[model samples]
Target: MTSCDRFLLDQPGGTLNHIRPVPAALFLAASLALTGCSQASSSEASSASEDATTSASAADFPVTIDAANGEVTLDSRPERIVSLSPSATEILFAIGAGDQVIAADEYSTYPAEAPTTDLSAYDPNVEAIAGYEPDLVVIANDTNGIVGALAKLDIPTIVNEAPATVEDGYDGVAALGMATGHVDETAEVVADMRAEVDEGLAAAPQDRLRIYHELDEKLYAASSHSFIGSVYDSLGATNVADAADKQKSGYPQLTEEAVIAADPELIVITDQVSYTADDVANRPGWENVSAVRNGNIVTVDADISSRWGPRLPQLIESIADAMASVKTPVG
Candidate 1:
């Protein structure tokens, strides 16, 4: 199964770009097909209409936002918002814009109250999205010229692509809040996330722990350059995958020998659909590894780990907890 995808695009020459990591062979194919279809971003229309607004200051209406696609102006609060990006959907709801959302993509499954439809995030149908008649359509990754198509129909859309770092994530959250006319709410959310992350970093063990983050069973790993890896880096944890990411693609495929050589102190499994911590421990020669010997294995939620949404605090907490759990810290 695939994990939550990040805002990062595929590396040149067709490398896996999704937040989900897979074997090198699999990554090539998926990445080649995954992000290649994105077309030119639509500039979008300015000045939202009444149907576009729900609950917002009248002064806030006719607001203009500079986004990934282009400059988008909302004349009024967006009462009917169609979210095609799961990350965006989460931010929308977290910033008090959930009530304004009319429909969301299939993968936006965080808030049970969200009106999740069969609309595909991977293969979005412009007609289906437009059918919602939403005044504001928000998308993350564009495919098949979705932005241009929507523009052709005079449907205003905003491209709030994925963030590559925690700060970028915060920016996106703030942007969404402003977009939905919840400026104060977005500011508070960012402040809270910052406080939680800072607190988590403060709680990290003084000794630097070598971390091996298992993206999947195929042994695809995330490097210090990766978004998830950035979290570990902030915690003062060392990423063993940094060595494997020779090209600095952030995502890399590691051989068994590479994993053994790294000999990480903590093994963080991002997804368990293909294998479990026990399965990793049982791998040939893995039992001799420091993490395996010390029973220092942490399995994290794939959804929470992958998306850089409001739940980002939770991921940091999980990693910080793992760091705190290392009883016999390696010298």
Candidate 2:
């Protein structure tokens, strides 16, 4: 099955604006939806009352946070935290906020126990999420007007943008840790991730090998500026997209001619569901490419490679292993 489109919204024309590379919902509107039910039902009313009481008590709050939503003030430690971003959810759980996370968007399938809801990060229904009674909601990508909607509901939110570099990933983890009162744990997690990356790099082949990262079967590629490219860089793979003749988005569409000419030594295909090693090799002119001729194309789990969170160590190791396993290109 095709990966669910995360945050992209259709424009007036047929063209698609590629949003951030994660998750599909924003939840402040869900809070607004719950307001109506709380008034009509006794149990709901009690829950709402308890939430208000908690907010009023202010347990070591209001914590002022600077995020994509600007400065957000939290009146208390969030008891019911909803995560709309998969990466944010992963980070939250990594920093020991899993017990506090009451709900997450449909895409947060990791950790197995994350309360995955029908909520769409891209088409978030405010009432649906508000019903969960979240005190705080964390979003990785807010391209779908979620921040403004949550702002209108007076709901606290932390917007974590997609990381472009490994350092950015560490920063995101640190921010989520601070938000969830798990500062030290977050630091430890970041340190561990950094160490893993360093180890992967240390073991990477000293000789540079040209690589092409397949974002999709359509030949869309990730440049060095992308998170995947950072991983490949750590493994000492020279990304051909970074040296492409035609420049486009960080995730660029490469023509068959261009890719063939680049003659990448290794092809890392993230869209494994659609393409296999043989499938890639069978492509019309791909037989001439060094990767295809030498069977150097590697298929990776899209989930592990795409999401930037605690699993980054796994991703780095996977790429490094692929690099180590590929046969030397025959001249």
Candidate 1, run of 10 with poorest lDDT: 10-19
Pick by lDDT: which candidate is best?
1
- Can you write out model 1's per-residue Cα lDDT over 1-331, one digit (the tens) per residue? 2432332321011111111111211212222222342122222211111112222233546656567777677767789999988778888899899999999988788888989999876787999999999899998877778888989988878888766667667667756765677755655666677778888888878778999987767788878877788888888989999988889877788998999888999998856356788888899888778899899988888778767788888899888988889756457
How accurate locally, in lDDT, is each candidate? 0.72, 0.68
Stretches > 4 Å off in candidate 2: 1-60, 244-248, 329-331
What CA RMSD would you report for each candidate? 12.3, 13.3
lDDT of 2 by residue, 69-123 (tens): 6766665668899988888888888878899999998888888999898887777
Let me know the TM-score candidate 1 reaches against the reference structure: 0.80
Give the TM-scores of the predictions, in the order they appear: 0.80, 0.80
Q: Lowest lDDT 10-mer window, candidate 2?
A: 9-18
Residue 38 shift from truth in candidate 1, angstroms: 39
Model 1, residue pairs in steric clash: 5-19, 7-162, 47-75, 48-74, 48-75, 52-77, 52-78, 52-79, 53-77, 62-75
**lDDT at position 130, candidate 1:** 90
